[model samples]
Target chain A: MSLSRSSAIPRSALTTMAASRRTVLRGMALSGLAVGGANLLAACGGDDDSGPSSGSGATVKFGINEADGSGPAYDRLKGMADAYTKETDTKVSLNAVDHNTFQESINTYLQGTPDDVFTWFAGFRMAQFAENGLITDLSDVWPIDGLNDSFKQASTAPDGKQYFVPVSYYPWAVFYRKSVFEKNGWVAPETNDDFMALMDDMQGKGITPFAFGDKDGWPAMGTFDILNMRLNGFDFHMSLMAGDEAWDGDEVKLVFDTWRTLLPYHQADPLGRTWQEAATAMGKGECGMYLLGTFVVDALGENGEDLDFFTFPQLDSSIPADSLDAPIDGFCVAAAGQNQEAGKEMIKWLGSAQAADAGNNAADAPFIAANSGASTSTYSDLQKKSVEVVSAAANIAQFMDRDTNADFANTVMIPSIQEFLKNPDDIDGITASIQEQANSIF
Target chain B: MTDIEQTRAEAPQQQRAAAPPQGREKKLPTRDRWVVITMVTIPLVLVVLLVWVPAALSFALSFGKWNGFGDLDTIEWVGFQNYKDIATIYPPFWPAIQHNLIWLVFLFLFPTVLGMLLAVVLDREMRGSRFYQTAFYMPVVLSMALIGFIWQLFYSRDQGLINDVFGTQIDWYGDPDINLWAVLVATAWRHTGYIMLIYLAGLKGVDASLREAAAVDGAGEVKTFFNVIFPVMRPINLIVIVIVVIESLRAFDIVWVINKGRNGLEVIGALVAQNVIGEATRYGFGSALAVIMMLISSVFITIYLRNVFREERTR
Candidate 1:
């Protein structure tokens, strides 16, 4: 036994040493480029010729967030790329990554070997990247023919330069099954009292008033965005998102207090349920409404024929409910990318009505194209209503996660909001916690 | 000692005696010496570069604030500010520490014990023992992320098999009070299989004579295991304990797959990833959290290594 044990120990040690030797070699090779200053400079210099300088016949590497062959999202992107290539005779090389992976690694991706034009969102993060010089200044892409002033404003960074080209947008609203509402003779609420009555009426019929879930931790932010916009007005909400206001201040405290009152009406124990499950509940007529983006239609696998929505009702008489979260999805040019002019030219074309039409016509589901000239003939009733509601809005705010600093929104607000959901009565405690974390992050 | 054991013990001394005298006479040929130096130096340098360098950098960065943008010059020195904020103001920090402790305790209490019991029962080689072994060890073959997904089908609130079958409205993965225990249950499902396999291997290595000696002395099965087999398996027990500690400390994937460790599933590993891996870009704060985690792991590791070395020295 001792002989076998001694022999086994040496064999295992030898194997471990051999394996680690191989690992060491591999590590040295990789870290040679990573850590060696001269090698890194050489690598950067080698990247210079990766793309052509001119537009015509040049390949523009497009890094899309959706993985290839995923769904309509990928199809839409592909369709746009194909359309661009066909029109401009320039190849659009695609680098597709999964959505969450793309979002999480965005900092490293931008700083590292990013593609020419990449899928991005118009928000604090875009502005952040622009400020850091990680993204190219696309001020020349502005005054895009089909895009409206609102889109140009959304695409602008804090430096007052357009750094993004918005392709599409979707508004967060109170979504309900049109058939169910019609069956119950219910009308969309316009005032705070009307909204309360609707909830009470739904409760009287033994239906959950709201099909809410916050397991992913960002869905609930839509609720807060609308509430804050309604209660404290758009300016205060925007200022608060920008970290210019204290979270413990009454303005922010009131949002939580109001959310606490409405908690009982929402689906109970929402932390376990996902937004998809909540949307399913509303689709099944088990719940009266779900406050979510138009993507809720995707969860239900419906063309949104049975779905309709209204902007959340005005909570205070003084503040108009016209302000809503209509987060815009767009593309940005990477300053590190080799083909700067080609990327800019492609992005400018992407902002046109033709690209939007091409994208919508190819996809199973269509987005509300940001360009006003995009044909709405393919839009469902729900989408048309969304377009109308968004266009008519006096003010548009990005969702809470997008409007605020990424660190504050992700590391602070997500947990703080979840805490509020878990214990609705502790408004002061939650707000104070948020304020403390926000102070540190900002 | 037997002849084989004696020879095995004397083998090192025999090798030393076979070699030349110490000093200049003991040196290898120049080429062979160069090969030896290269082999030793390369691995040492790699280890220092790959592991120690990053660890040291994490410690240094913990004292500064950087958003992972721009160059190294952009890092602002803030001297213990990140640590102060984590301790005083970070909502997830304390809960993450508490959760890690709960995870360790729960893994030890539930899975480790249950796995040993399963191992003992299966070691009897009863009818269909192999089938039971296969069934129990299946989850161990799967990754933690896959285990999380598999359990999600059972634990999901509205559409899960548990709720559908039991007709209960339990939010198994959402309620902060209940979700931690619910996740622990899922972890145990996988952990039990792991511990059972390890214990089974250990049990298989136990000599049959030890059990026979206990049986001939009129001791019962439980008594035989407790009095004889358990002590004989001390090495395995220590290994199991260390494995449990390491597993609990690195418990991130399952919770991350579930909800990115939010809403009461805030393990330290997930917290570090949340701040550092994602767009949060709180590099210094994340490094501080990482440093705290490293300190904690080092304490356990030190105790474990000391115990292991002490055992080796005594042997």
Candidate 2:
């Protein structure tokens, strides 16, 4: 008749549950932890630790939408929050939520006056927060923290104010199988001919040259973005990114047509398989290569054999070479956060190189630190090389969907790419439809 | 003993003699009147605030241009335009409505037939009959989200259970030809178990003498089932039919999970979800869809309600 947890439990049960969680994590980390189905750590949130802390001191609620990446950073963040709580006599409650539920919690927090500091990504995504006056501008915090002006410019608001601190910047590049390259007697391609010939050679050998996870639709975009850079050069990409109509010009078609020609090789149940599963196929050397953001490092290390990678092989060598999926994930203080001063302190701690060090200690840290001079030896050799591939580039383009409206990007662009890949003959119609969707949105 | 006897006597004194003093009985303070008001006011105010206000707001917003945020004053008054747009003009309207109707048919017909058969079979008190009841309704306990993903796996072209069994690579999700049916299969799977249980109850409620009487009349087994058992199940049939109609019209979770309401299959629930929670924030449009869903559902509700009254009068 009663549905309440108001009854206190003996302390023994708490210890037992915590002990079992540790055992589960250990069981999960061992090789072949699961058959066919891969088991990732679950992320969940929402807890009943509300109201003022009373004599227990002030408490701050925090939410982290946990993506199953390296598990270490989450632990570090929890520890840091704990330390902050201990130092300031404030109770820190860190809520780890699943990515799928992120939108619900975010909308709730935004709608209701939130009693916690939460995470948000940088770039165009922050625009909604900024427009609604929901996010705190960290311009003052940015300068005090001594974060490089270079990184700030990439994600700073048009008003010359910063809304978020770049906790981590991802490095993106194409991953290829070392064993396949070695067996095929092919060195890493330096020229357009070399790249195509290597691909043709792999295709001739019945290896899918480009193993992609278009299940998400964004993965096929990696190949397209690389082609854009190859055909249009870095400056043209910048121009198109600046909302120039030249995006649909002949040079862009050349890029689109490049994707059209690659269809024959990708025809094996390519619709709706995730990027990680795509990498699983590539990692086992079943497929020749997979072009992905370095973030895929989190997915590829099933048995600790990280696939080797190269800068997406250049077409002109004069054109910039970068991966298709480098976006930033950072934290920001909400405009009306209760603990503004404490939040600034948190941002300063997050922006430092040590933060990156703690964040990347796990086996699956996607890329090296964003801070230019920070050391990243803890990362896999392929990942470190991928990071260098991005940093060394004179120019970079924002991933397409990110640089566009999220609605159009996910719904129209992604599905269009998938449909086009299923049959390239759908290009003209799909492109026209995409252009129309963009036109309507913009 | 004297005090106890006096109290016992006083207990019955009202019936015996104190009844004469009732007109002038000792009156509690009029303050108690306020207490009654306070007790009733609390519940009345709460109900009006919680239920009536939201219902009013939903109706009001069905005629607005609100985009799911901020001050209520910011909502634009758009007249019957929202309704006009949704009724026939909107892209996802009619096709989705047609699909929903098809779903209503599927929901009632398939389940009713299957449930009656299963219930009749199980009601025979055959060996392990209890086990069959438990096993039959097992899927009702599973989370629909889990069921959706499981069904998606079954429908998958590669490494899927169904495809593996059939030895044919069918694009269950992508191929628009059979995707809706694929989704319907999962929905039917979860709902059939419950519908079957309801029939099991109806079968139990049937009078034993009637079926025996029909058999004694020289009716064949099928004839006895049709002539005797079928009539007794009409009430349960009406209940199951109404519930299925409502569930099918508001079917959102399975379809939403399968495709997020995309891949060219549009239904009213999915469309409403898209406008409200999907990338689009057309709250007014979503409310318009909700109102329409309510209107469509009320048709089935009205039929069932009228049947209830009619059955009562007959009884």
Candidate 3:
């Protein structure tokens, strides 16, 4: 009656089992390994070591989100690190981790022995860390030249203290090749009617109006963000993201309803395509336009030179088309770093226009530095355009995922949105489910 | 009778001569006793630490809520709330259960049987059997991540080889109805090879005389397989069933890669990962999932061990 290890041994003798018996145990053992493996990962949080480093020379470890081979993103971060090292005469150790891994491990990384200054995104993601005391307050780093009020606001947490240092930003918009637009004699749409007309015109010309993809689940959030911003306005969208606004509200419903109407104009089977693949379709002229971040150029590669973008058209006349999802990427100081003083110093310098310029100058595919004082001489047409749109914007969103609780955004929103994409008709059900889940989490 | 026997006769006296200070029974040499203690203690410690501790922790954590940050004091004991939510509110839970069961049944029905058949066919020393064996076994050696990536080349909707070759446009990985089947097909490709290798090894070990004896008794190949050889390879059959169950229950990597187990590709393991593995630290909810999965696995393990114990009793 007992299920014990001792019971397993005599059965081998009784059964005269084949060698595959061992292999069967190996399979079971593999799962046992998986259980232990997952738990080991769970147990990987770092012990608190908040004491300052006792070393003679000042040094700081920076946990970079860019791995070595990630082209320009890595190059820019490396450039920043080198600049910091040169300015302070202190060594800044760069511990590079892959982007996704860095994000996934952020909770553990922060609780554990995190590097002094780590790369991170702004908005609610940063605010969450600040709330938990995972990151150091950087309010003292304010009044950085070339950084505007909006950039400063993005860095500030709920407690009126800054946790993030603005570095660069990219806005999501409707990207199109200038060559295709010129050839087709198409103009950028400004209002809802004009947008629909453009979509109709593109469809008539035998081109898919939009190159859409949602396989990763987050790409479609950019669409949802713009639609919500246009229809409901920025304040409402921000509140919706903050979980203060109901997801099942009529305003949110309108966004979904409008999206449903526009679905036909988007590329079919979007759940199957990655954003890169969709971007390729746009690049190849199979699709007329793509609504994505400026980084869509990376996917376009050579055709990137011809890339031009316009902000998503306004749906409600009362709500200006001034707000867009311009997710700001930046750096933060780990509260538990051994060298907090050095970390804060480095983060302050990181906020400076000179640091932005150093990073921008060192990389070929330079980011649109948040500091306006950074050199714009190396700016591409797209970069120049992005800066113009962002500056002109009355409100900015850190995209849907960044503007909400990580747990809620990932576990609830990703699937709910994907579910909506699968069955656009179930807007009511989807929104209700979202609200129910949000109620629990928030 | 011999010099060694004479020495053994004097061993107790010799041991007593060396150390008689303490009242003690005769035992093996201290070195050998230490060695035995070390051997027993090490594995016991490992089994307790690696297996039982985590399993127990997972079960305990299922009753609590925590975001997997800060200290243990942060964990709020919410007793059964996570499980309640998972069963009632979580959309992915039931679908994940269904998919896991489907994966088990599908693996058993197709790849396990097909692999055995392939093993039997290749068992007859046919021309290029070695080549066929290598071809079938190639996918088993590849990591599941690589296999998922390779299949994406064929499963891509607009540009995949399947569409280009067949002149059809089915979203293999996107359409909910088709994506599970698509992923299952990829998993079976690898599973088939694994089962084939194991069955082939088992078939190789089958006594040649048993088959010859059946043949002499006027048994055809099919009849011989069923009547005699199959019955004799019962142990191998049990092992195969065990392997299949284990493989299906732990089917996470392929589907996770496909879409993080969403939109009909949901499996219990993937759901756990989706909640706990990434930035989302819904720890209690994920632990409830892990506990439920463990409970399911325990049923199969119990059945397996019971069958083995019953067989042993008969013997």
Candidate 4:
């Protein structure tokens, strides 16, 4: 084993540097030229607002996990890519991998030779990688791209610097069957009490008030995110998650109470079902509603079910929610990436309007780009209404799964939520375990 | 890696193909055979370079400390810290091992009984025996990921077909209490047919005359089979047991796919992967778990191998 290890030192794992040598050298040479090329492309086509320069032989390989295929979603992306290629002459080598293998493949790709730009989930998940210097610093490019000031301070800890450009922001909302709501004469509510009354009325009509699949476990976490935000505003939620406070506090207890109250109304056996399965219930009108992201539109379209969207019901009317759900997904460059300039350009483009449009038009709409000064939406009214809620939100917290340190997320947060559902009596135990787990990692 | 493999062939080739002083080359079949070995060994070297080398690195990963991805030198040397943790020290570690042992027992035993019975029954020239054999053998072809999904749907407490048919709800992989039984049931369904096929092969080789002679000597059918046919299928029995043992040891996908081992169904394989792939990023811990699993599996293999060798020694 020792013999093998010593001999294997100069093997393919180290070949990452060997592989990217040419690409990095080439990209650096191009970056110097791209500074010149950007003026020409921007001046030539005033309509094309893509920041990453494109001319003859200027191409950046943008790695994405979303599948780009013959779906309407992909068609929209192709249209945007087509526009992008024509307008700027910059070819974003759209390398889309399967979602299931995305993390593993990206890890392999980055270690071997990082892509110019890649899609990343925001919060500690990306923050850890950024800390390891696996991700790049886009600080030089962020201001040049005209990113929002609020985003600069907010995405700072996550990006290792105020480097990430917010392209498109997505919001999660509760989606319900239009037919079920119409049949029951139930309207969307403005407060927690009104929502509960509506849920009771729907249950009286023999409809499940909520449908959720905890197969991936994140669906429950998503529900918890919106519930906490609605019960206590988004700032308190984000701050509490930042470990500034404990989850056992009264405000957080109220959030847990909301889950306990709604548990009876939820389709109880969502135990082994995937998010798609749970959302399919809402699509088939088996359940009155499902709380999910803009990604639900594709599932609804696949189910051919009509649906309406609504935000989480807020208790305090005075303080604004900004939005009811957690907004997630972002792009981060690898700091140790071989093609550092390409990586920066990729981040710059991802933060630019064009990348946001491409991202929105992909196989599934993950919601409009989180970019400021634009709505950036192509979803249905139900989806658009939710996006609007986020745009108008006073503040939004990224999903807890992504936001929290993964130790706490996987070990404490997920198990606690699952345990709470199985046995709520263990709340004190759950609270203690969560605190311990958080401290161990933090 | 390539240099080590091709030394016997490549050294002579370069000398003969482009020697410093070109002399008359040998036209013998020995030289021709040597040339063939050289040409063929190049691809093999490349394959090892690309595929086998990485695999070896991953295998080494089961020993040393390195997260799934990072700088090479950053891999800390922890000795057998991970293995010691799992086998003797860690809290959750032993529980996972115990769960795997429990899985191995059920995984081998349940299928053996079911397969042996099915094999004897099907050994008779029944009208639809071939169909039964084919149906039982079908699940062996399926990937574990697909099977996990199918069983998950079966064990669904609400809309599951099982509840609809049996008029009772059971959360298979979700509820913390009943999940092991659910995982075992799914695993058994897949293995039962495979064991049956092995037994069927064993039954074909069993002498029918010996069974008849036993029956003629005043043995009943049940007594004839146990005293007669059962002992003869020992070799086949060993094969089935060995497979089930190794499979139970290496089992990962079904557990991972089914709620990521949340519902008390956590096994050794699941534990190993969680450290490597999930938030823990504890490579040494994962490797330690793997080495423990390997040691346990080796014991099982060694015992089975000893039995087979012992039978041979006696013969």
Candidate 5:
């Protein structure tokens, strides 16, 4: 029976069957390719021929940091583009790239064939490009309605000319679930002593007082920023980030010393945990609070109905705790682009409340629009609180990575902060190492 | 038949016709000579263009400070300042060197020895040996990035299998004091499969009569392998050693996927990528690190080539 079974499938017959199967697969693959090609051609044709012209015949190329088919973020950007095309005669063409790829290759991209307007962060990252003449001066786009003085300050480059158009921002604050806070009879602290007492109360109840993670090496910078602002005030913190102040000075040491004292209240072994895992712990009621941006809601996969936040309370009576990190996201026009006037005109409209509403209505998750005139009816409770807290602040600092030189911030501060996290007692050693590297880079 | 016979008949005449002028050496036709020259020149040009030019440029760039923003004329010549800063100020540099040496030593001690033992045992034709071979070699088929993610399931502190199973909260990929050793353990899982497959192939090529002769002379199994089989596989042993050395020097993708080589997982390759490939744009500093890595690799490569040439001479 075995011999007959082996002889039943002759080698030539098996080869014929395999060949037929490959032929069928090839036929299917060709049809799939034909359909894909037709779709691509149709997309290209629609972009060139279908849009109505009301403002001008010019087409402004926009380089977005989000990938083409990515969810809400891409949808919001596309919605704004479509809205602008309808309001104006000029056409907007989008060139979408992955977020990390766009950032890493930004230097080459700006120097090479950059699009007319591109998504970017406000602060030193924008100023660097402006200084190098890679981006156009958009001073004419300024005095935009609904954008206040703080937004204008964030948009201006080092040369006292507007180089960026403010779009949206999110504030970093101490976030806690309202249910957890109410269950524990803890109100948001108003002073340094009250904050300490709140942490003690949480610890006594056998819950970690804070959810902390620094595995990606950037989250810990948020802690340092708040501590520095609360202890040394806002201007000193900005000077320190700009490499004007010595890193091993007394002001910096005090920030580290205060943070070290509070380390015990944080969740242990944070280097192994990601921010999402830390947020999960807070959501599960294992931790009492977390200090992160409002995007922490996205990590917890909820609409943030249960979430509420307060600015970190006063650590020193002399230094008002009114300064906070509220990083602004915006757009810049490339100097090398072919249609500079159209790019400036589009960005001018992009900074308006109408553009903000178009984006918010399209996306499932909405950004906190930078324009104060933007509609607040669609904001979640958490986002509404964020908008209120941010506007009330006396000084708004961009986060550490965005405010400083990219080289020093990435290579020096990231490792220095991680080292401090690993060994909190070595303030002198860590600060000295940072100063030495900072001297070399700056 | 006619073509073969005609070629045979003409071979002596052609050789005789060319030999007189060239002093017993037959010359090639112009077309064949051009083919020979073209084959040799193409690879020579490619190697010079792709490999040597970049290496030379890296060495030159190491001496200058450039943020990769402008033309070549914008590069400021800084002499050896980059190398000085790397030695004195860069904190990750020394740790990365120590980790690389540890990687080399650990690979030699654990995976290389373990793989040879498994290869010898599997050569005995025991029951289910095929199944054992497949199980041992499966990791070699996977990429290092995939291996890192697969092991992350076991190494993650809160969500991993190891902590869950053991009820211990060890930070396998986090704590600086222990994470390097933890990463090395994961590395050995993939590396053992690779070394085992190479040794298995080497063991198969050993002459059966040499083993029989050893047994006939009253040698035991271990004794026969050590005395007769091991020395006979000298070329394969050298190849395996070179491979392990090369692999350790270029060890990057796994640790990079884990944490971008921060915390406890820094290596030379990762440090280079951190400076050059990211938004840092410290091209001059990255080139210095690359040059240092190249110098370290050339030392091992030099020793390997010298030994190989010495063996060839003796043969």
Candidate 6:
């Protein structure tokens, strides 16, 4: 492994400058073969690493999950690349792909010849790759100023080394329209009794307390994550995701049973409605509140200016409401990347507030940068609030999909959750099935 | 010259040449032999590599656990563990099987019969018959992905056209009980056009004199169709049945487009894709699902082939 790592440094640099030029020529010859089926792997490998401009300066390929053309995310990434190039003289080649497609193809993208630095999330997914040697060890790049210890903890793998660099993040919370809440004389709850009373009050007024949807099968995970964290605490939630705690245990049952009591307060037949449609309901004041990530603004669109959120109330007094699902989006250096030095340098720079400032300045949709030193002048009220909520949280859990094995989460948990939605009464059967599958997978 | 003209000219010559293989072999030029070899070998190689190799690989992978990364050495052989887990613990497996069977039966019963009836009606060459035929065939030209999108406009619960029209909310795509039937209706809309087109072509080929003779014998249109035209159109009927069976078994794209085959739309194909495609590379588990699907397809293939061969022998 050491030998392989040592050899990769020069190999990547050489490949960037030399092999890239030859690949353009080879790509033309092999286009016919590549267009067909079997040689696609070879074709993609040739296209991703290097571009036509084989400049004398160091080059790092940055695999961006956002698509090309005009978008805030694309502009932000482009700005980051330009800044990185201007400052360090390292050409950052951006390979932009559609977000979902990028996610679905991540396994192949990593195992194959991946870009030097690629966008990723900080959680169990990152740790899994780190354990499998698909990502480079980035412990040396840590101690970046303005990034708190919580971000570092999220970035660290089980091996006691960091594999990720936190850039931007968004928190999951109970969001509502300010005007609607003000008109109804409602206040954000702080305790279990307060929350229940608030729900009852909303119900008495003929308003659905919660705008819920699970048609896509992932939105409900936010609800489960928050509920589990509040009831059993973050340690138990993490263990549950890690396949350590019994899914069929009393703790999990309590979470579901508690959820069942609150189900009546949520919008009916959520399996039919998408998260966007549900968010729109809250935007229209048809529902009292929505529990989701800060990106729920995308669904609210222009009306998002009216949006305000509060963290989910404390369920158990023993466990404070300091934990929340605030999934951090970041970057990782691929183990298979040729230019580890350039990649590490790029990652190190990315962790700094300067990079965040550069990224935010480039786009209309400014991200709530992870670095405390990042500029806040351009931030929207919501982005500023998101930063505050995330920073104050003691323990942050990445969303369910990011916090567990991909196969278990996608294949087992998605269907399992959908089933639970259809038949909320069958908690025993649902938990048993989840446990059985989880046991097999783990 | 056009393709048909060229084929017409070459047809007799090719047939005459093929009659005596021994004589042709001796006289066959080296260039022609090379061309023939290349033509046969390319398809043969393609079929083996594209179809047989993947099928065999899936079978082999079913016995091992792999995440579709690293070298072959990374595959840990777990014997029948994946299969055991699927049969015993997997929630979607049983539903996928049931859905597939339901799809087959629904297609055969509704679309096949509806298509035949429409073909019969359109065979009369009434005024504006061409317009009706074109209108009926329109959905067939649209891709299944597009069809799924079109139906989503009508089926959405909160703001769907169906709810607006009826003033009643029905979860068309979300309710496990009704979503299957709702999707089947959309699928049938497309299938009906395809079957109708095939049957129309078959109807046109049925000798008109037979119908005239039935009419002379005091037979009505219905009697003539059942007694004379139907038996004569056995070949076409058989083809329609085969097409329906194949379409039903391979029903995937529409359901997949809707929800990746979740929430009461769990087909075998979608389940396989859910596991194997994209980043969810549970190679062993996915392969087991695929192998089971292949076995189910083989049963249908065997029955179809046997019926075809038996018919040929009788003829």
Q: Which candidate leads the pack in lDDT?
A: 1
What is candidate 4's CAPRI-style docking category based on DockQ?
A: incorrect
Please report, as a residue range, the 10-residue window in candidate 2 chain B with the lowest summed lDDT.
Answer: B1-10
| Model 4 Cα lDDT, one tens digit per residue, B4-65 | 23443454567676854534464448887799889999999987865456445545655665
Docking class of 1: acceptable
lDDT of 6 by residue, B1-315 (tens): 132245445756787777876664576688988998999999999777545765677777789887755666777999999999888999999998999999999999999899999999999999999999999999999977689889999999988999999998899999999999999999999999999999999999876777777788898988889877887787799899888877776667788778888999998877776776635668788878878887888888899899999976653
- Tens digit of lDDT per residue, candidate 2, span B168-271? 97868656556777777787787888888998998898767667766677878788788667765776878787778767776666666666555545677666
lDDT of 1 by residue, A259-320 (tens): 88899999999888899999999999999999999999889986888888988988898877
- For candidate 4, the clash count comes to 14
Docking class of 5: incorrect
CA error at residue B99 for candidate 3, angstroms: 0.6
Candidate 3 deviant stretches above 4 angstroms = A1-57, B1-34
* TM-score of model number 5, chain B: 0.90
DockQ comparison, 2 vs 5, better candidate? 5
Q: Judging by TM-score against the true structure, name the best candidate.
A: 1
Candidates' DockQ values? 0.37, 0.05, 0.22, 0.16, 0.19, 0.36
Report how far off residue A121 is in candidate 6 (Å): 0.6
Model 5: per-residue lDDT, tens digit, B149-186? 89889988888899999999999988998989988888
Q: Estimate each model's TM-score.
A: 0.91, 0.77, 0.89, 0.77, 0.89, 0.90
Query: lDDT tens string, model 2, A285-373?
Result: 77887777765656765423445776776665565454344676667776655556666666655677665555555334333466654
Local error of candidate 2 at residue A130 (angstroms): 1.6
Report lDDT (Cα) of residue B134, candidate 3. 100
The list of candidate 5 runs beyond 4 A from truth reads A1-55, B1-26
Q: After superposition, how far is residue A177 of candidate 4 from its true place, in Å?
A: 3.2
Q: Per-residue lDDT for A1-442 in model 3, tens only? A: 0111211221121111111232234334433433454464457435443433423246888999999978888998899889877876778889998898788757656765668899999989789889888899888877788889999899999899988998999999999989999999999998788888988999999999999998988999999999999899999998898989998999999999999999999999888889999999999999999999998988877736788999998789898899999999999999877678888888888888899888877787889899988888888988998999999999999998899888898889888988998999999999999988888778
Q: Alpha-carbon error at A415 in model 2, in Å?
A: 4.6
| lDDT per residue (tens digit) for residues B1-315 in model 3 | 133234434756787778766645667798989998999999999877556766676677778777765566677899998988899878889999999899999999999999999999999999999999999999999877678889999999988999989999999999998899999899899999999999899889877877887788798999988887777678899999999988888877787777887887888877777777667877777778888888898899999999999986664
